[model samples]
Target: STTAMAGSGLFRLPAALNPMDWLAQPDKPGISPEPSYQRPQGGIEARAFGNVVHLLVESMANAIARGEEPDVTQWHPRAHALLRAEGIAPGDLPHQTQQVVRALENMLMDPEGRWLLAPHTAAASESALEDETGRHVRTDRTFFASDAPLASGEGTLWIVDFKSSENSGSDVAAFLAAQKKLYAPKMLEYAQTKRAQLGAETPIILALYFPLLPALVYWQAE
Candidate 1:
């Protein structure tokens, strides 16, 4: 197995043999239809916004796993500390902090979102996984179940990648269509990596959670 061969230290795979390399080729056709609207790549402010959201979500998930209610009020101070630690300027901290809170609140209000954030027997935030060959992928969040079927009744693993885009005032279906095209390959790589690590029989489900837009976009492996 690839994971078995990938012992220690970093090893590079040839571009031709890498699935992610193939997906990154500009000429490659996408599996999903094009989106009606194009999402702009995030700027520094946007990246900082996403970082803050991630920190807040991780803190909340950790609290939930410990059987405690997450205190939303604590997020601001935490965000400030994290930003400073990351060398991010405090100029837009107030605006971005509020955005993070709003997004978290929006996610908790939705049924699917609530379930996604709920405590699990085993859960990881910003988890890193690497194959034996040194190919690595970092997942935003992962949930593990022993016996029961996860969402979509496909497998025991549930993986989520969060998007902080404000893709509003547009058709949700159209936005999702574009998102699938943009995210499918990476998500597929994540699933494939997990499958390789866990074994072939373990089913996996990958979902894109857009907290700002408050949408959950799911894709099943073919």
Candidate 2:
């Protein structure tokens, strides 16, 4: 269930749950016509798993733009703060831990503005999202196209579901369970909020990225 987490002005989402079917069999890898499910690239869908790479990059950008150090748990805040001149105390974390985090942060921010990666931005940029964008609705309920809340350029939302049985131990059951527990509630929350934001229902777009079967299971509320 999409529990309403109240806190900051923005909704506080529970820890994200990756469906078992989200990743394909690490052992039985193959290609499929699925859009978001299968790795657009390759390699057992490792990079494409939840494809949070784009988010990680964009977050780095936002952190840079803000000038606030994103090193929440830097191993060595003392040295880091000294370098940035933040004059902050080094937390209890180990020096090596801090170094690793700082390195990752540096790597992400190194290119800086050169990298503009986000679902919407990348999709529009490559023009692949158009071909990739799809609509999917909950199997338990049905909503009309007009009943949708806010929508993307394709006039809908996307749930890029990935399914991996090889990694998850059980394939079909795991994938389906993920769709219901992890993806479905999240999609509903997105639909509800988009509608609230735009003051109207926007078509819901759900894309299930299944790497095991190499298929993108799509659903829409229309």
Candidate 3:
């Protein structure tokens, strides 16, 4: 069955996206230096099932990074079985990601009211954030790692990292916290530049999306 749904059998969807682009920061978008978050929001395509899309993208990227074409038409099934073996077969990936996106879209900058921060892409895993020396520092390394607007309509933005996993042998909260800690410095560094460019306030938000258990954890930066 080509992307057929029979109570969900883990078939690869027709869209096999390469996630490598996300791993390495692409050229920042063209922002007119406004009083906003720095990471420039909303340019990537965001569908309802964003995490699924991210999964597809990461799978493709991993393959292509090794110089192989990602054939989603016949790879997801094998991946699914691996998840099952890990004792984490979650049918919630799609909907959970959708809900997170909706919530984020509704999130507004505090005190004042503004809603333009858009979450265009999903990272699918924090494993994507590589250091300058190329050290993959993220520990959660779960599923659906992404960045969204920090609810501040204005420069220097914060990234929202979503952790999606079945929790077979993992602690969701701990994983979430660790990712935040690792990214805090990076977020600040990004804010420094963004604020300078747009005279925007530095990022004042941090978030985590747990798609498997349908949980969202966030903090407002001071």
The candidate that achieves the highest lDDT relative to the unseen native structure? 1
Candidate 1: tens digits of C-alpha lDDT, residues 55-86: 67877777777789788777667777765665
Q: Given candidate 2, what's the lDDT at residue 13?
A: 16
> Could you give candidate 2's per-residue lDDT for residues 101-185 as a string of tens digits?
4434444443311222222311221011111123332221121211112222322333333233223455655555555556566
Ranking according to TM-score, highest score first: 1, 3, 2
Off by over 4 Å in 1: 1-41, 84-91, 145-155
Better of 2 and 3 by lDDT: 3
* Model 3 weakest lDDT span, ten residues long: 1-10
Per-residue error for 188 in candidate 1, Å, reads 0.5
> Residue 184, candidate 3: how far off, in angstroms?
2.8
lDDT per residue as tens, model 3, 1-222: 011111211122113333234334443334222211112222222222333333443454355445674453454454444333333326743344444333322222221101111222332233333334433333222212212222312222234443333345566666556656765665554334323432443233445444444455454434
> How many Å off is the CA of 165 in candidate 3?
4.6
Q: Give lDDT per model, in order.
A: 0.62, 0.33, 0.35
